[model samples]
Target: MELLHKFSFRLLPPVTFNFNHTRLASLYLSTRFPVSGPAFSDPGPLFTSRRPLSSSVVSKAGWFLGLGERKKTSLPEIVKAGDPVLHEPAKEVDPGEIGSERIQNIIADMVRVMRMAPGVGLAAPQIGIPLQIIVLEDTTEYISYAPKEEIKAQDRRPFDLLLF
Candidate 1:
């Protein structure tokens, strides 16, 4: 349970969300959907795209990543617990920069690192990127390894790779 607390969703909105009504919370989010910045408080249109998202812009790797390169490993190291970036609010990603190569690589790297950590979710700042981006996966495989009581207590379930 301590491990789960450490590696659960790292960038949930400050406001509590009621997901009992919809399954969208577990779905993969695409950039084509218009975003309302970091403030999810506004009860307005979040996604306005009318066309299907391009496959190239979306990561095939299935999660988020951070920027910067480390020769020692393919994925960036997870920032330690006391890092300032972890406590500070990260800047929202610029809408125009979503499709850039750098962001794409970051997403890819984040996915790799998250899987390596065997965590359910990760934030960009976890990998040293100060952007308001996050990736999450709650797979059946992960669930199988946990105690039934803990899983029931946490309401954890298998969800697709979710990135935004």
Candidate 2:
């Protein structure tokens, strides 16, 4: 029994085999030690010829590569379309009002809300306030690929409305 055990272990050496070697060895071993399990009872087919998948498979690959999903932009509630306040011209905000602690607190709050909404620009009118106050930030500035001359011309405009 010990000799038989040693021979069995020797026949199935534990060397790591490449894919082709593994397949060939499995084929050789099948003839040597034919399994009598339910899985191999009928032996349906030995091998099926494998060809590259059709162009339909390429479509699946292209779908993943293209990333065909549009990003949704979220705007602030106060500055939405059809708001009466948005139509009304903004009132003049005194520099003194801007310096006030209350204004500072409001600005901080607005900044927090803007960050949460991920907005590029926010106006006081959007927040139900008629004050002529606005803040803007753009996250796409770094990757924007506009021409330098055009960007400079846009910078010369009254407001910095160029989207980087």
Off by over 4 Å in 1: 1-73
Encode model 2's per-residue lDDT on 1-164: one tens digit a residue: 99988877776676655679889788778767357876678868554558655455565576465443446544335556888887888888777677899777656656666657756666677777777777766554522555678768766322333211
After superposition, the stretches of candidate 2 with alpha carbons farther than 4 Å from their true spots are 1-76, 140-164
Top model by lDDT, which number?
1
Error of 2 at 44 (Å): 63
Query: lDDT by residue for model 1 over 22-53, one digit each (tens)?
Result: 54454424223445655454757645678666
Clashing pairs in 2: 78-126, 79-126
Clashing pairs in 1: 64-110, 65-106, 65-107, 65-110
Each candidate: RMSD: 29.3, 18.4
